[model samples]
Target: MGQVSDRRRIVISGCSSGGKSTLLDELTRRGFRTVEEPGRNIVREALATGSDALPWVNPEAFVRKAIEYASESLEAVRELNEPVFFDRSSIDALAHFERLSIRTPSDLKMLGEACLYASPVFFAPPWHALYEQDDERPLPFNEAVREYDWLRLAYPKRGYAIIDLPRVSVAARADFMLRTLGLPLSKAP
Candidate 1:
């Protein structure tokens, strides 16, 4: 399978409930393709099916599923010619393994190295005002902050530069990301 170039695959990641989803929604509204976060989908499915593949219930299973979902997401969009935004990627799954003190499988590590995202990965910094607990995201504010810390380190360790998205209106964030990518800004509908 061909790998998507780092420049065309953008990852929007960071703290939980830190507005990554909202920013992605804005980009989608402007007609960009986006991939949903794997954890949220996993949580939703686990809840509906009463499965143990939940982060709190079975973290190992959770991370495994996340890796699978993220990999599939990457593959699904590999052929797209336009910029494709991902809420989080397999690197986030690797970080979760780190958080749990588990050794990453060699294949997972290789996959992380192979699937490159755009440099200067955009991170939504911890936004206390915007943070809210939901069924899919049950982490407390402090834990969310810690996850952000881990991601801040993880992406750089994987050779990606980090760019923290400014705390501003979602539209403004979208415009900033587009401008930073040198893509044309979409006029408001």
Candidate 2:
């Protein structure tokens, strides 16, 4: 598999409750195509079925599902010409495996190594004040910080630059991301 040369396949990843979903929504509202977070959707599905494929319950299963989700999304967008924003990608799954000290499956590692994301990933740092828990997100605020640190290290080690997004309003953050990509900013109507 060849790496995507276009920087449009952006990955906005960070700790839980760091406004990744919100930022992705803002970008989508500005007319950017996006791939939603597969982990959250998997969590929702697990909750609905009372399955053990959850971050807190069976983390390995959760990681496997997440990688599969991310891989499918990546493949689905392969034919698109427009720059598509990914809420998270396989890298996040790898990070999770590393965090848990779980051995990453060979297939998952191969996928991650082959299909690298667009460089200079936009990282949403942990926001203490904005951190909140919900049904899908069981990660606590402190753990979110630790996750951010892990991601910061993980992405760079994989040859991707981590662009730390400033702690600002959601709109500003959205604008910052577009500007960082050298894309024209869409004005709010």
Number of the predicted model whose TM-score against the real structure is largest: 2
Instruction: Encode model 1's per-residue lDDT on 1-189: one tens digit a residue.
Output: 996543388999998998999998888888788888988989999999999999788887888888888878888887777788999988898898898798878877776556667787999999999999988788899999998999999999988999889999999999999999887676345
Compared with the true structure, model 1 gives a TM-score of: 0.91
Question: If scored against the real structure, what TM-score would every candidate get?
Answer: 0.91, 0.92
Distance (Å) between predicted and true CA of 133, model 2?
0.9
**Model 1, residue 12: displacement in angstroms?**
0.3
Candidate 2 lDDT over 2-105, as tens digits, reads 76454368899987888999988888888778899988899999999999999889988888888888888888888887678888888888888898899988
Where in model 1 is the C-alpha error above 4 Å? Answer: 1-7, 187-189
lDDT of each: 0.87, 0.85
Question: Count of backbone clashes for each model?
Answer: 0, 0
Candidate 1: count of backbone clashes, pairs at least 3 residues apart or interchain? 0
